[model samples]
Target: MIRHLTNGISIVFISWIVGMIINAFLIKTKRYQEKLTNLNFIKSKKINKLIGIGLIKWTVKNTFFKFFNPKLRMNNKVEPNDLNILRNEMTLAEINHLIAFIAVAIFALSMVFKGKYLPAFIMMMLNTLMNLYPSLLQQENKRRIDKLKKVFTRNHVSVTATESLNIS
Candidate 1:
């Protein structure tokens, strides 16, 4: 049992590394975004509600962000261009996670046939926590960004028009 468990763990870790590398390559090549965007299957509202993201565990997410979401150079106030870029980055990441989820599913399913049930179970749990939860967070964030975009666009145009009138 110990040996089998060790073997299963090794497989799961190897799968994770390979999946990350493949997803990174796809992202570097700019293929993931277009591919995922075309599929258009991620429905944020239902997914979030289904996962109970709005519940009390959101505090855990806040804690998770402090450690994992390293915003290296982001300031308190971001320009519209920067916000758009961030939104795109989140979208791209969410897609890569979707890919990761699929890879995990494949690995788990494949392992079950080989009698590595423990590893398969581990992979599925990881898939739920890492891939699914993060995707939901990204979707929630993107929606928030969209709201900001609308407000920014509205305010920016009005401010520009006011400046033009003053100059005239």
Candidate 2:
């Protein structure tokens, strides 16, 4: 059982790496970014809470994984450009996890067909926790960033208009 658990974890990590590599290629295309940006599996915060994304988000923020990608965190004051960068990073992360989840899911299904129920269960559970949850979390964060970006732009436009009226 221990060996199986270790192997399952190892497979998940390997799949994650593979997914990153694959995403690097996919991201070169504009269509990929557009699709990911528009992808909304959950529409509202209430739905996000019902699905437990808040829990997964809290876990990532509180765990060692918080240190995994420092660039994703907005520690200081965020500007419009910074929000754009973070949104792009979030999209990259979301797609990477999505690719990893699909790959691991295929392997788990194969294991089930082979009657390796224990290993399959282990892989599926880990895949859900590691890949699926992270992807969902990124999507959630992206939504927040989008809303923030809109506010910044709107405020900027209004301020510019006010300045023009004053000049007039």
Tens digit of per-residue lDDT, candidate 1, span 1-168: 566556555654455566567766776665555565434345566766787655413643456544444431234556688666777766665666666677778878998999978778876776767676666666666666676668778887322322221100
Which regions in candidate 1 have their CA more than 4 angstroms from the true location? 1-19, 28-33, 37-47, 55-60, 72-74, 157-168
In order of listing, the candidates' clash counts read 0, 0
Each prediction's TM-score versus the true structure: 0.66, 0.88
Q: What does candidate 2's lDDT look like per residue over 1-168, in tens digits?
A: 888899889999998898999999998888895676667787788987997887888888888888867778763456678677877888888898999999999999999999999999999888998899888888878777777678778786322322221100
How big is the RMSD of model 1? Answer: 8.0
For model 2 the local lDDT of residue 79 reads 68
Q: What is the lDDT for 45 in model 1?
A: 68
Worst 10 residues of 2 by lDDT: 159-168
Model 1 clash count equals: 0
Q: Compute the lDDT for candidate 1.
A: 0.60
- Model-by-model lDDT, in order? 0.60, 0.80
